[model samples]
Target: MKVLVPVKRVVDYNVKVRVKADETDVDLANVKMSMNPFDEIAVEEAVRLKEKGIVTEVVAVTCGLAACQDTLRSAMAMGADRGILIESSIELQPLAVAKLLKSICEMEAPSMVICGKQAIDDDSNQTGQMLAALLDWPQATFASKVELAGDKIIVTREIDGGLETLSMALPAVVTTDLRLNEPRYATLPNIMKAKKKPLDTIAAESLGVDTAPRLKTIKVSEPPRRAGGVKVADVADLLNKLRNEAKVI
Candidate 1:
């Protein structure tokens, strides 16, 4: 079976995101860019499936500017058989990306899709579900554990109430959450080999999927600085603060 994994490029997790000076968007000028952490986990899971011989091929695809090829290379280094890049000049929103992935899905015909539950940049957490809805495929979101049983895919997901297990047939979509699997660093040899792997870049417009941004960002700004905490003198003082100052009581 073939599994398609969608990876995204975003600011490295360690970086402190800064809003643009004009309050238009996050400052990307000379910012450190890397694969989305959740997407990294998804790639790791797909690679593991391939290693287990459960998946014949693991194809990594991404939709973004030319720089996103680096993200795809990272996926290939992690064991994706090949990479597909849908290059777009404009910033892609979740719905647009889902539509593009749907187009690619029609073209690739992969039996399953694995993707990050959310992108750290936006934290929208909507792509996988949107893709599943667009494709009319069974979907399991926030999957912590995934297993293959014959023609079915079993996924254990996290919920506020606890874990939820779901079983879906072939041709499904699963989104990775934290604790799914730790991503493996690409060894130097694999990193070098990834350069030689087949990577095809397609213009996003050629897919006939509208790549327009439907939502507009009114402004972007950093959150207010957190206030320092105060120490209470005793239980009475704590209760007094909670009732009078903090207002919780």
Candidate 2:
């Protein structure tokens, strides 16, 4: 089976975030960036499938600025055969991203596509589902486990009530959950090897799709800082405050 995995670049989770001066977006300048945590999980799952001989080839793809090439290389270091970078300086909404990915799907023609349930920065859980819809293919979202058998895919998903299993035919899309697998770090040797791997760069315009920004960010602001609480001498004092000032009791 040929597997296609889509990865993303986002601010490293450990770094402290600051809102930009204009309050339009977070400050990315001089900040350390890494692959989205959820995307890393998807890449790990895809690599495992290839390592186990279940997948014949794995291709990692990403859509973003040139800086995102680093994240794609990370995916290659993790075991993807090659990488494709769809260069786009402008931020793409979920629908636009899905459309571009659909074009890539047509070119790659892989049996399966894997992606994170959502990107960390935006937390928009729409790309995978949208891509599936555009392709008119089956989708297994929030997948905790995935198994392939005779052109069929068995997916175990985590739902609100409990786990649910479903089966879908080949040529499907699967969005991975956090518990799916532990992402491996890129070793030094693999990192060097990744530098030599083939990376295909394509412009978004070449895909013949409108790359316009569909959504507008009217405003951005920081969440209000939490207020400090006063200490109460006794339960009666607390009760008094709750009953009168706070008005809870």
- Highest TM-score among the candidates is held by which one? 1
Kindly report which residue stretches of model 1 are placed more than 4 angstroms away from their true locations once superposed.
Answer: none
> lDDT of each prediction vs. the true structure?
0.95, 0.94
Candidate 2 per-residue lDDT, tens place, 1-249, comes to: 889999999999999888988988889889999999999999999999998899998999999999889999999999999999999988888888899999999999999999999988889999999999999999999999999998899999999999999999989999999999999999999999999999999999999988788788877778899999899999999999999999998
Please report how far candidate 2 places residue 114 from its true position, in Å. Answer: 0.7
Per-residue lDDT, model 2, residue 59, is: 96
Per-residue C-alpha lDDT of model 1 across residues 1-249, encoded as one tens digit per residue: 999999999999999998888999998889999999999999999999889988999999999999999999999999999999999989899999999999999999999999999999999999999999999999999999999999999999999999999999989999999999999999999999999999999999999998789999999989999999999899999999999998999
Query: Which runs of model 2 end up more than 4 angstroms from their true locations?
Result: 233-244
Candidate 1, TM-score vs. the true structure?
0.96
Which consecutive 10 residues in model 1 have the weakest lDDT in total?
203-212
Steric clash pairs (candidate 2): none
